[model samples]
Target: MARIGYARCSSEDQSLDVQIARLTEEECQPIRSEKMSGASRDGRTELAAILDFIREGDELVCLRADRLGRDTRDVLNIVHELDQRGAYLTVLDPHITTRGEAGRIVLTTLAMVAEMERRFIKERQKEGIAQAKAKGIYKGGTRRVDREKVLAMHRTGKGPAAIAKALGCSRMQVYRILDACEGAQTAA
Candidate 1:
């Protein structure tokens, strides 16, 4: 009868440390399953570890519903799965626990909205790319510091570190520009 908690984060800078701390305060053992993205596949190792330890009537805690899963189908599926396993989910910030009807409905609605928004963004991007291609225009522009600027600084006898400083980047960028400069001469 272990009350296990699962903590997830979208990126490195967004920490699950605080969520873990809260879970610890609640006397629950926290499993941290983090990723660089939310768009990946269905499962996470930390979540699996939490599931492995949960028993009937055991509670699963998270900071927010969004931290658990991203879309309607995914969230509902996960919630349903946990319920079938006799485990309850509690999201701290919104104070929603799937043990009640209102919480389930709220979670479902939020998931649906997020999924719909994601679909709309994908559709819009596709349309934009299609329009640009139809007009014989490139779909993307040069990098923030593309070839011309890199070459211009290098031709001025700027060293890698100095060039990186001038361009507000790093020494690696300077080396890349130098390599590109060498390749440019070969191409000519």
Candidate 2:
């Protein structure tokens, strides 16, 4: 059984050398590393490659569960795949290995917490966006987006969905402006 090690750091300011050291101490053979944000599926190529290489009786070793994936759904899928293949996952610092029933339960709990944390972050971000919009803040520090072309597109028999797609605005914004245009037309 291969005990493959994985390491990652989300930013340039962080280093993977320390994680490598710890995993090496644990005798995790053939360390795979990446310096990229684990914010989503895009940054998980190395981890996914390692998982692909692993087979039944293989073990995946990482410094921590967070090191594996920031999003719970990501690792939960990995864990389920591993479970199906009769493979094991070992988090060195946490000292939890999903090689048995009890280990599976612990991993499941962590996955749930990870999912909850993800939802909470999304909620906070939504509220922050609402607050920013109320204060006339544009995302990415950009100027206010013009909706003129969007309006023209709508006046030409294009639906709000199409206008929104072309303008890169939300359907709600498109609907709001369309309603305003209709009201103006009626008043005139």
Candidate 3:
């Protein structure tokens, strides 16, 4: 049976080195990794590929249950899928494997805890933001797109797609800027 590994992180800024090292230490081969949020199963192409190609008797390994997913439903679904394929899931931290009924119960409990922890984190963040706003320190998130640059490009007869390409941003962002500018001019 093949022992495959999967590593994931929430954002590009986060490192996957530790997780990868742990998986390697466990003698896992062909480890797949991605820098994406585990809050949801969406946009996790590497994980999807693993599920798609995993064969019977193969085992999917991760550093922790949370590395597999933070959502309980998603994690349970993944485990179910693995079971259906005659494959197994091995989480390193708690050292749990889906090779037994007891392991599945513990995994389910851990998945629930992970989901709850995610909710707690979000709640804490919201409270922190509220406190910052109360102290007049919250100026909202920094803008990644340049409104002036978008307007300048549009004035030069550039289409939304062309402007987005030039600014290295999405066409929807370009459209939003253009729409806001148009609305402001109309009001004036």
Give the Cα lDDT of each candidate.
0.72, 0.77, 0.91
- Residue 118 CA displacement from its true place in model 1, Å: 4.6
Clashing pairs in 1: none
Error of 1 at 100 (Å): 1.8
Q: List the candidate numbers ranked by TM-score, top first.
A: 3, 2, 1
In model 3, which runs have C-alpha deviations exceeding 4 angstroms? 143-188
* Pairs of residues clashing in candidate 3: none
The residue pairs in collision within model 2 are none
Q: What tens digits encode model 3's per-residue C-alpha lDDT throughout 1-188? A: 89999999886567889999999999999999986678999767789999999999999999999999999999999999999999999999989999999999999999999999999999999999999999999989778788999988888899988997787665666777888989999999
Per-candidate TM-score against the hidden true structure: 0.58, 0.61, 0.77
- Per-residue lDDT for 1-188 in model 2, tens only? 88899998865457889999998998888899876555565635678788777888989998877777767777878888887888889988668898777877877677667667767887998889889999987465442336678677866999977876676555556667777878998999
**Ordered list by lDDT, greatest first:** 3, 2, 1
lDDT for 16 in candidate 2 is 88
Reference-based lDDT, residue 150, model 1: 75
Point to the candidate with the largest lDDT. 3
Predicted candidate 1 versus true structure: per-residue lDDT over 26-132, tens digit per residue: 77764555542444334355566666667788888877776777677778877887898898888887788899999999888877776776678789988998899
C-alpha lDDT of candidate 3 relative to the true structure: 0.91
Looking at model 2, which ten-residue stretch has the lowest summed lDDT? 138-147
